[model samples]
Target: MDTRRPTIADVAKRAGVSKGLVSFVFNDKPGVAAPTRVRILAAAEELGWQPDPVARSLSTQRAAALGLVVRRDPTVLAADPFFPAFMAGVETALTERRQVLVLSLVPDAAAETATYRSLAAHRRVDGVLLTDLRHDDDRFPLLAELGLPAVCVGRPDVAGAFPVVNLDDAAGLRSAVDHLVGLGHRRIAYVGGDVGMLHGRRRRKSFLEALARHGLDPVGVVDTDFSAAAGARAVVELLAGAVLPTALVFASDPMAVAGLAVLQRQGVQVPRDCSVTGFDGMDLGRHLHPALTTVEADPLAWGRAAATVLLRLLDDGRADDLELPSAALVLRSSTAPPPDPPG
Candidate 1:
């Protein structure tokens, strides 16, 4: 009976599979058959064989960990359902690789950049996943100069030389607009996240384009910090506007949920007095009083997909741009036709 740390070759021999197969399964790479993956895992467990992450990193001259720096207010991160769900998906991928996820929550862009630089200088991670992209993101060139490989969650205006994981959300945005228009919502208002953020701008653009496609004009637009409080405040402002919009589309589920609560407090009958729509397809939305109507974007899938690309880049030195599953619109009781006009 050998009483020593097992190596990749040992696992391969025990599993009766090639070393490459074992590597693929451990790294959660595609193209490995399900049965083979199961067999490999079973063999490794039976032999008490666990890959040493530190040893592997030392030998490979790589950190064997991934970094994610979120430039968000801590309150928003706690309130928003997307970040948690997305991180769960990232964990699922990291679990197989026995890798670590180094997450940093910063208040602003300055702190965020410092965090990235620190991570790179400390050799704390092999690559990073950049989220909450900003217009003319400084992280792109900074990361490139640091020699740190990265994958952007949203398509930056200028990718320079990095692989991006872009979700086709245009269809979902269009569907949302079309849904509102069908409900006799001629005056549609948009509540977006920080216009400076790449996703925020992209979604806002999509919302406007969707309206144009249906031959409707935007009645109002408000930008928020993607916080519940911000959402509530924006809702109040929209409701107080000269020409009240019958439908309000929010950029994220948390904001939408906040807006719904505000509407309820203000004696606004949802889908009766005014209708609301949210994005991010959070499960919490389904349990809301009226079951929120929203565009469904799977954060978990986004996380897993982004992690997959980052891992591939680490392994192969280079990876191609990946198009993730498209977002779609979900209909619920939150949206309805406007009330009849006075005769």
Candidate 2:
């Protein structure tokens, strides 16, 4: 009854091959014939043997890992479906290449910056994926100085050295506004997330511009931090106002969902008393009572594309910015004509 983790020597002994050959095969180095490579891999698999990350790093100066430093409260991150879907995509890409993802959740911008510095200083990761691109992002300069290759998830206010994999944030928001306008929602209100982030601002601007295109003025606009609590607070503020808008468009699904809950609590019937719309097209939105109408963008695709780009940058020392398809609005039961249209 021996209980011990198997080692490379065990794999080699099982396969009747030298440990050096096993190393060569595991590292994907050439010179090991195809049959021998397969046989060695089979032995390692049977023995449950894997390379030691520390030894691999020291030997090749490659951590074989990617970094993702998120600046968000722990609760906030868990509440947002976007991060999980996006990380799933990133991990999917990394798993194919036998790489690991090193995630760091920080409380604020300063802490995020320090985490990036620490990762780079220790060579903990080969590269990083930058999410939540902000206005006047200082991380670009720091990452460049640290020589840490990165891929930005969204468009930055100013372009920098790294590549970006961003969708057109304005297109989806504009489409949401247009749908509401077409539904005869003239006195529409908007609930947007942090305008400090570039994507947030882009969405807000798009909503305003779309309303202007229809020659309609927004009844009200509320800003939140894209968290459910912030979204709920914004809804309360909107409800407290003297008059209520016919339709409300939210920047994220969680916000729209929260707003819907608030509307329900206030005895406001959706699409009857007020129409509602959301962004992100989260899966949870689909299961709502009336189902949610939303603008659908592929955050999962963004993660995959970003990871691919970052890995390429690490390997080739350069990668090109990618532009995915603009998010499109999907109509559902959440939106309809205003209850009381002008005669």
Candidate 3:
């Protein structure tokens, strides 16, 4: 049996290119022609040659990893259904490139900034995936100062040079609102996440616009922390009001699910007393007693797209912004026509 590891020299010879050219292609450095790069890669693949991680890192001055820091309570992150699915999507792309994900959850902005600075200063990650963007996000400037590459999961109204992977939050809200309006719901309420968040503001703005288009006014609007517990609280506040709305639109499935439990406990029959709709069509929504009516925005796809963009930026020093699938309304048993008014 012949057993010998293939070397770069062997690959270069087979590809009819110099060893320097092979190295350039493997390192993903600029100045390599497209055809030559393809030939070099094919030759390396044909020889079953995989770059040694340690050697590659040393030569490339890269960490071969990415950073993701969530500015939320660890408990909140653990209970929130979206993070797990989204992280899985990110891992799918990272696995393909043999990259590592350094994930952390912190309590406040100071901690989040510190985490980013530490990662960049220590050369622990090649890039980062920024999530939960705020209206006046400071991370963009910080990242620029750190000279670390990044991709935002949400589009910021403020301009920045970094690529973004964003979904159509406005369109999704419009669809959700339209669905409720179509179901003979005249007085619709909106339960949204923190208004400080970029997407939260966007969703609320869209909701108001949607209501205007239908010549209706919002019965109520409540903002919460995007947690199940917070959702329950919001529902309680709405229920305690002078007049109850015919329908409620929640910003997240978690909140909607929690609100459902609240309604049931309060003896309010879903879709009879009031129709409920949620954003973020997580699998958990389907398993509910009455499947949730929701705006289906795939968090998994969002994560994958964000990771892909960051990876591209890391490799080539440039990447175009990506727009993932627009949000679609998923009709389920949670919503129905408003009950006939009592004469």
The prediction achieving the highest TM-score against the true structure is 3
lDDT of each: 0.88, 0.88, 0.90
Model 2 clashing residue pairs (backbone): none
| Per-residue alpha-carbon lDDT of candidate 2 for residues 148-201, written as tens digits (9 for 90 to 100) | 888889888895887888888788888888888887778889999988888788
Cα error, candidate 3, residue 276 (Å):
0.4
* TM-score of candidate 1 relative to the true fold: 0.82
Residues 161-280, candidate 3: write the lDDT tens digits. Answer: 789898997898898888888889998898998888888888989999999999998989998988999999999999998878889999999999999999999998997888999989
TM-score of each: 0.82, 0.83, 0.86
Model 3 quality (TM-score): 0.86
TM-score: model 2 vs. ground truth: 0.83
Give the candidate number with the greatest lDDT. 3
Q: Report per-prediction Cα RMSD to one decimal.
A: 7.4, 7.3, 5.8
C-alpha RMSD of candidate 1: 7.4
* Model 1, span 1-343: residue lDDT tens: 7777787888899889998788778766789888889999998898788767775555565777999998877877898878898899888999899998999999977898789889999999999998887889898889989999999897888846888988877789889999889888898999998888888888999999999988888889999888888998999998898998888999988899999998889898898988999999999899998999999989899999999999999999999999987899999999999877659
